[model samples]
Target chain A: EAGVTQFPSHSVIEKGQTVTLRCDPISGHDNLYWYRRVMGKEIKFLLHFVKESKQDESGMPNNRFLAERTGGTYSTLKVQPAELEDSGVYFCASSQVGAPDTQYFGPGTRLTVL
Target chain B: SQQGEEDPQALSIQEGENATMNCSYKTSINNLQWYRQNSGRGLVHLILIRSNEREKHSGRLRVTLDTSKKSSSLLITASRAADTASYFCAAPALSNTGKLIFGQGTTLQVKP
Candidate 1:
């Protein structure tokens, strides 16, 4: 089966500019997630989507970041007026619904905000 | 915030030697997973040990969990250059486990 896939493998933008990163989960997978890793830091959870509904978004950083899973098929994370600290790798993952399953990740999008 | 922490930030070993990495976490969890990532790539799930389990093995990978200590260890035996990667441990929060918080990761280098 094809694994999770992400677009624009790398993105470079300026501070105060906007950037959108996309993620396409494995087919038929209802659970999708977004995570990020800043320089010299651990990867962190951002949000979770089950089908067309958001399961949780507690990890989302601030008001400038918005993630949407339209039709629960694919996901997009948009950073408006990005900040310098927003420069990092954005990762997307998917898994079978419920617990006790493993999540597969895609090649992350490396975002550089100058 | 990241709940899991990997020890020894980095490690190096010969191809024939074994490499072990440890992870510790705070708070309760249902399961803990391990993942590997090359220098410029996404994470690949290595193994998962449930809260009730003590040990699991797949190929050359062995993972052990100790609830009392809230820690886990991953051992890769007879390593190869392909094993050179950053290893991370993840523990999903009890409420929304689909979102996994990861450790800082142990960077392992297996030299031939």
Candidate 2:
């Protein structure tokens, strides 16, 4: 019964570079979600992935951001040409679709765009 | 977009006192949840109250929802230094959507 886990706990990249953050959710969890909290801001939802398909991406900021959940197991969020504002703590969460509100979160990756 | 917004951005109280925080939202919700976050860390789920329910409790945590006013409140009874953390309220933006919008959060500092 492991909890959500995220990779690259901290990332420092150039403004024009690309970065990919990964999240391994709890085993048997069908709902995976991405969220972030920028400087002086609240945690905000980025997208939701139910299994291998994206359930909702309305929270996605712009085109430069892309998210995918492969094989309905793990998820990856990639940001190309990252901007200064993209620097924030990126969090990944997972839950059992049967109980959607009982989501468990990961440690989060601290992304710093230089 | 953010759904619930917490009041009193920060709070401080003695260890044995009770700390109450309020959250107000803009629309209807399927379920409202509370979470606690340590500094520079992930958030831990605290409690969840469904739209049809008015109040729920777990351990020392108490949660109440007022759908009529589109607001919710979280009360931590007999707080402790271990309770020092930021608290947030979240609600699903749309039913069956599997998405949640979180509040600004209330920072609680329980003094021993």
Candidate 3:
């Protein structure tokens, strides 16, 4: 039942530095998500959270990126100052809230913004 | 900004043969999901098909949808080698806000 969990699987920062990635959803699952995939691309959608609010973030990609969940079970995506295409791979997903479920993802972090 | 495109991006079968992947999208969607990633990990849903539905299966995987050609297809019969990996197709925009949108994947290689 523990299927969504992510935290520093890999992260190498540099360009302006400031990174923070963490996700822990699966327990109660209230629908949390954040996705990314640079190099070669095709894995986007960058915001969603149904527990602590924030049901959508219009695929966040600017404002230095920033995501939080606070009391929503777990979620954090902060990419301040980072650049160099912001490296890639930083997924985290969860589901089970409005039905039509099945999201479950995590084991991604691999950010490298040299 | 990616909600379509996925085809022969890569594929090499052998194990038990049988591997097909194709997905194409642009707009209007309510469901259509398929995911499986290996090299590097994360992503593994593999089947959703909604939007009125057209076909779906799980065990050996088999999905097909063709909303007037919006496109969608994913077979995976006897393949193995853990079925190689990298196969994605997702959708959920049209303002539903479920936020999905993904494609650009296929890379399957089951050589044994």
Candidate 4:
């Protein structure tokens, strides 16, 4: 089966600019998640979506960061007025609803905010 | 706060040798999972061990969990140059959100 896929494998933007990253999860997967790994840091959770509804968003860094999963098929994460610290690799993962622990990750989008 | 912490941030070994990595977590969990990521690639799930079990083996990989100490260890035997990668251990939070808490990861280099 095809694993999760992300668009724009690399993104470079300036501070105060806006950027959006997209993720298309495996077909029929009910659980989708977002995570980020900053330079020299661990990969941290961002949010999770169960189908169309968000299951958890406590990991979202701030209001400037927004994530949406329309029609429960794919997801989009947008950073408005991005900050320099926002530069990192953003990963998207998916798993079956019953097997949430075994996640399949996508090639991350490396974002560099200058 | 970070839940898992991996030991020996980096390791290097020759091919056909054995490599071991350890991970410790703060909170209780129902299961722990290991993932591997090659350079510039996404993470690939390697194995998962539930709390009720103590040890699991998959091909050349062996995983042992110690609930009393809240620590887990991963051993890769007969390693090859292709085994070079970063290994991460993850566990679900106590909140039931299904969100995984990951460690900083252990980088392994197997020289051919």
Candidate 5:
């Protein structure tokens, strides 16, 4: 089975620009999660989705960040008016509903906001 | 606030030697998981030890969990250059939720 996959392995944009990162989870997996790691900081959870509905979003940093999972297939995270501090690696992970603890991660998208 | 914290921010060892990394968490958890990440790469799940289990092994990897102490350790025996990576320990933020709280990670470099 294919593991989680993300798009645009790297992205460069200016501050105040909008960027969207996409993630396609493994086939038949119902759980999808988003995490971000800023330089010199630990990886932090952003949000989680079970099917098309969000399971938890308490980790979302602010109102400018938005995440959606449509049709319970793929997920997209949008950062509007990106700031310099938003530059970091964004990782997408997936796991089976029955086994949510062992997540498989994607290659991650490196976003640089200048 | 991160739930887990790994000790020894970095380590260097020669191949064929043993590498041990420790992690401690603040809250209760059903299980603890270890993951490895090569530079600029995503994380790869290594092992998971439940609260009730004291030890588990997979090939050259050995994981021990002490629920009473809220600590865990990962041991890689006869390490190879390929084992060089950043190791992270994660636990669920809540026993019923899948949200994972991660540690700062320990960078291990194994010389051939």
Candidate 6:
């Protein structure tokens, strides 16, 4: 089976512009999650989705950051009016229902906001 | 805030040498996990040790968790150049919400 995949391996956007990152989880997986890693910083959790429902979003940085998983098979994270601090590698992970911790990660989307 | 902190921010060892890195966390955790990230790549899950378990091994990798001290260590035996990468330890928040807080990470370099 194919591993998790992300779109636009790298993105460069203006500070005030809006950017949307996409993630397609592995087939037959029910749990999907988002995480970010700023330069010289640890990877931080952003949010998590259980199928079509968001299980946890307390880690989301702010209102400007919106994540959606309409059909549950895929997810989209949009950062509106991006700021310089938003520049970082955004990672997507997935896991089966039985084992929630053995998450498989996707090659992150490196977002650079100028 | 980051949940764990890895010691010896960086390490360099010759191939065939054993490489060990330690991680210390503050809160109670349901389980602790180790992950490896190659440059420009995603984080790959290495091993997971439940709070009650003290030691676990997979192939050449050995992981030990000491809940009493709230610390864990990862040891890669007979390391190879391919073992060079950044290692991170992560744990779910105190709430156990399926989200993980990662450590600062230890960058390991195994020179051939």
Best by lDDT: 4
Pairs that collide in candidate 1 are none
Return the candidate ranking by DockQ, descending: 4, 5, 6, 2, 1, 3
Worst 10 residues of 4 chain A by lDDT: A95-104
Q: How well is each residue in B1-112 modelled by candidate 4, as lDDT tens digits?
A: 8889998899999999999999999988999999988877888889999999999999999999999999999999999999999999999988766789999999999999
lDDT tens string, model 5, A76-96? 999998999999999999988
Best by DockQ: 4
Q: Give the per-residue lDDT digits (tens) of candidate 1, residues A1-86.
A: 88899989999999999999999999988999999999878998888889878888888999999999999899999999899999
Model 5 lDDT, residue A99, Cα: 85
Better of 5 and 6 by TM-score: 5
Q: Rate the local accuracy (lDDT) of all candidates.
A: 0.91, 0.92, 0.86, 0.94, 0.93, 0.93
Clashing pairs in 5: none
Give lDDT tens digits, candidate 3, residues B11-81.
Answer: 99899989989999977787899999898888888789888989989999999999888999999899989
Better of 2 and 6 by lDDT: 6
| Candidate 3 accuracy as lDDT | 0.86
- Error at A75, model 2, angstroms: 1.0
Candidate 6 regions exceeding 4 Å error are none
lDDT of 1 by residue, B1-112 (tens): 5579999799999999999999999988889999999988998899999999999999999999999999999999999999999999999876755678789999999999
For candidate 1, the lDDT comes to 0.91
Q: 1 or 6, which is superior by TM-score?
A: 1
lDDT of 4 by residue, A1-114 (tens): 888999889999999999999999999998999999897688999999999999999999999999999999999999998999999999999989998877889999999999
iRMS per model, in Å, is: 1.5, 1.0, 7.8, 0.9, 0.8, 0.9
Q: In candidate 6, which residue pairs get closer than 3 Å at backbone N, Cα or C atoms, i.e. clash?
A: none
User: Reference contacts recovered by each candidate, as fractions?
Assistant: 0.83, 0.86, 0.77, 0.89, 0.83, 0.80
Per-residue C-alpha lDDT of model 6 across residues B60-92, encoded as one tens digit per residue? 999999999999999999999999999999998
What ranking emerges by TM-score with the best candidate at the front? 4, 5, 1, 6, 2, 3
